[model samples]
Target: MTPPHATPVGPDLPMPFTHAGVDQLVSIWLAQLDVIRDLAEELTAEQWAAASPCPGWSAGDVVAHVLALESELHGAPLTDHEPDWAALPHITSDFGRLTERAVDWYRTKGQDVVVAELIEITAWRRDDLAHAWNADSDPNEVVTGPLGLELPRERLIRTRILDTWVHEQDIRTAIGIPGGLRSDAAWVCAGQFAFGLPYVWGKKAAAPIGATLDLTVTGPGVSFERLVQINENGRAEFIERTATPATVSLTLDWPTYAAASAGRLNSDSTGALVANSCRGDDQLAARLMPALAVTP
Candidate 1:
């Protein structure tokens, strides 16, 4: 869901325009994958083993997860293995176990092997995706995406771009090499995640009808201000302007906003609620904070 007014600002940053074709989206996804591959190639063994922001996933594990998904998308068979559920308390859902099977398989291999496998798999995926999709392909054609979700091709590719970029940030955070925040992929991810604010407010937070929320994201990569209003039908939608003051307002930096939107800010190990500033309805803001994470 790309927000109507969310515009990514920076030189050469590609905005996820509503009319963007599959080719443009694929280009963004490929760029994000290149960033991850380059970063992985430079990682030290210690950094590879470092714990990422994803609970129970090391930096290498995160890479393996990405490799696992792309490999599946490229027609590679799933690894026939089941992880020890009791030992993996962080894997609380069926999808977690499904993804963990492949990640855990790679965990037994050495760092060099993991990196090499990622490089190989992603290379294959790049070629496969290029052949599979083109600018004229139907963007609305439903196709299977990660976790077996059926989505339009354009949306699936956009989701891939978002996931890859987020994992890249996870790796960077783990290794203390924070960067790529201003990349083309970062702007895409910013808009993609920010698009879920209405869902976060209406469905997750259950804000009362007619209530309005103002969300301001300060970004070096992509900056935007969103005004979400719950309508008479109990649905939230962005409004251009309103006469009444917002019921609540929250401001966050780009990185912090990304982390929170991806549910990383809820991590017991690295969560930082202090990174955000809230005003107006305190109770409503508190409710909205936990519900901010739109992704599972």
Candidate 2:
């Protein structure tokens, strides 16, 4: 259930997508890589070691994770890889283990080396993608993702863009350098996450069959609405519009939504944010809003 809060109020606005499509997403991925690297270039030694919002990972560790994944895609050796994460509780997924190993090894070489490698790998990928991405190619072709899971090429690349942008935010948050909120990366991240609202509402929140809900997410230079309804098949699906008025609706700025979705906003904070933005049927909104977060 979405926790009760005291502050769920906000203004209504329009949402627009300026960039989308497989090739466009691949381009965004490359652009975000540069964004991360450029941000890393300004980090001081102390800043690089500062803990990011990601539990137990420093800003440098986050950067290393990116580098590690790219290197894997490029088939670069991880070198003398040793598994020392049995003691790390968060290193549960295969992908987590891989990132940890890469981060641990990269830390030994120091921040400068890691930053340089980031720039190099990003540059390589940018050039490679320029010639490799063909809009006519199959988007559903299976490809190995950074986490070792096989996903369709289109899905994998979109995940990569989202991950890269999120980490860029992580680095910025850690070092107090936040400024990517209006970029293509930010738009794509929010848009992609918004696509999962149905699963979160229907399955996680257990909304009644045939129930309808509306959402209005406002961010810097962005505002969008989504409709989620349980179909006759008893599945929650994102529909264009409902014949009847929505059962509930929520309106909030993007930062609060992003923080909550990323699990950065705790239950109390989330409740306050929701209370400030939610509009009708407070009980129903509370139950559905918290369930909107489906990211891993």
Candidate 3:
């Protein structure tokens, strides 16, 4: 029998936002908001100003970005502040510059103002999600994502959960307050990484036909194993169970894997965290590094 706490992978596992419904996604998002709120409540002004793991983003800036996104989701207009994009070398696109301006604006407001805004906006968002997902809303209905593409509403929720949890970790890392590893939000973030493995294995890594790769991720409250195999059709697919031995086996904790996949962790940091056996395919293992970064 499986252990009582085990989260089984494969077809037996409930599809995210399907069996448990959209409420699962909403709950994870809310939990992350709570984490941010608590951290905000405790943070000193000095802590807020400290730079986060995300380049060019201080801890306070990260919170401001979250507030801006939530405000947009709630149909609140962004502040009419235009930043000179040419002066900002770190900002590559119009969107990046837009967010930078929001962060800069919040930074000028001081710690109290920004923290209070986070609390208020997140509370409002929680209520909005509760009402929206109720009353005959279709989880699969197409919704506009941050990138301006239509995605299934459930898929959007999953993306939000991943993004929020990652930012929370970024804040924690910045302020030296690291404790969300056991939460449902963390698992949700980690689960989303599995969705990118097919692209990583087939397109990025270019695994040989019939080669299998196995990844085992461990964390405080969750542990999961994922397997990907290249098929005769020259495509990679996740298998529920595979009798064939894996050509490469990788072991890493969830946070490291999450950071690497999000492109937040450098290759040196990622290499330090991963314990792997390439099984005579060292070149293939090296190829896996770039593939690990699926988030933009």
Candidate with best lDDT: 1
lDDT per residue as tens, model 3, 1-296: 11234553442353233343677667777778777888878888788888898887889888888877777787776677766667657788666776687777776788898888888988898888888775356888998765355899878887888888888888888998877776777666766787788899889889899877887766555567788889899889887656666877776676777777888877776555443523436667777866798776
Question: Against the hidden reference, what TM-scores do the models get?
Answer: 0.91, 0.84, 0.88
Per-residue lDDT for 137-184 in model 2, tens only? Answer: 578899776656898988888788778888887888899876777677
Which portions of model 1 miss their true places by more than 4 Å? 1-16, 267-276
| CA-lDDT, candidates in order | 0.80, 0.74, 0.74
lDDT of 3: 0.74
Poorest 10 consecutive residues of model 2 by lDDT?
1-10
The superposed Cα distance between candidate 1 and the true structure at residue 101, in angstroms, equals 0.7
Clashes of each: 0, 11, 0
In model 1, what is the error at residue 216, expressed in angstroms? Answer: 0.7
Per-model RMSD to reference = 3.9, 6.0, 3.1
The weakest ten consecutive residues by lDDT in model 3 span: 11-20
The TM-score obtained by model 2 is 0.84
TM-score order of candidates, best first? 1, 3, 2
